[model samples]
Target: MAQLIDLKTFTDKRGNLTVIEKVVPFDIKRIFYIYGVDESKRGGHRHKQTIQAAICIQGSCRIYNNNGSSEAYFELNRPDKCLLIQPEDWHTMDQFTPDAILMVLASEYFDANDYIFEPYSAV
Candidate 1:
């Protein structure tokens, strides 16, 4: 199943600083961001070998995850909030705020065979 975690954050007079380190379970090979989305949804599939950590660096968005037998929903509204998506967890991102900037750290490089578009129920 996907897990939601809080990133370490430091706040002071200068503002807030959030850091991503030591917590991710895999070595990151790819980094990407999603922004300027309309009402449409994104990520309607799971991965075969890619684990991902998603952070809403700007605004907010809702994520739906299903790992075969279980399911969960996560809201990433802050830079300090992260959603760890396992390779087996099927997920979708929606309900994005206008200014939402979702950054994803991936465990593997791009491979067409690594993607599974079918839902868990269909599998």
Candidate 2:
């Protein structure tokens, strides 16, 4: 199962900056976003050894995660809150606000074979 990681965001007169350089548990190698989807649309099929941390930078989103035995729903709306997804966990992200921007931090570089696109199976 994945864990919720609450990040520290420092605000100042200039602006607000959230420093996540080497402070996060996983090694961030890639960054991506899921956006422009209509209602009832889902993303993320499966991952092998990749770990990801996702945050709703703008607007709100719901992430459905299943790790064979347990299922959990994470509602992300705050920029400081991020959900760290473990390997082999099947995640389906949906219920996004129209202007929602889902930012993801990946532990590994892009690898095509690391993703499983079929129906999720217990690993």
Candidate 3:
């Protein structure tokens, strides 16, 4: 199951700030974001060793994750509402708003070998 992490947020009259640290099991080595995806499409892939924490910094989206035996759904609406994904967990992202910005913090750097495209028993 993925962990729903409520990240540290500091708010003031000016604006709000959220901090991303090494609170997960591994240090963040790569950061990326997804945008301009249609609602009919989704992220249909999983990692073998890389862990990720996904957040919606702008707009909203939904994420579905499965780990062979169990499944979970997450609504990434706020920047502080982070979904910490572990290895071997299959995930798909969809239901994105028009201007949604999905940010991801990865435990490892960009490596094509880290992706596991094997078919798992997930629906």
Candidate number with greatest TM-score: 1
lDDT of 2 by residue, 9-100 (tens): 89989988876665568768999998876887575667888999998888999998888778889999988888999876788888999999
Instruction: Show model 2 residue runs off by greater than 4 Å.
Output: 12-15, 118-123
Q: Estimated TM-score per prediction?
A: 0.97, 0.86, 0.91
Better of 1 and 2 by lDDT: 1
Pairs of residues at least 3 apart in sequence or in different chains that clash in candidate 3: none
What's the lDDT of the predicted structure labeled candidate 3?
A: 0.86
Q: Sort by lDDT, best first: what order?
A: 1, 3, 2
Which of the predicted structures, 2 or 3, would earn the higher TM-score when compared with the native?
3
Q: What lDDT score belongs to each candidate, Candidate 1 first?
A: 0.95, 0.84, 0.86
Assess candidate 2 and give its TM-score to the true structure.
Answer: 0.86
Best by lDDT: 1
Worst 10 residues of 3 by lDDT: 114-123
lDDT of 1 by residue, 1-123 (tens): 999899999999999999999999999999999999999999999999999999999999999999999988999998999999999999999999999999999999999999999898842
Deviation in angstroms for 30 in model 2? Answer: 0.9
Deviation of model 2 at 73, angstroms: 0.2
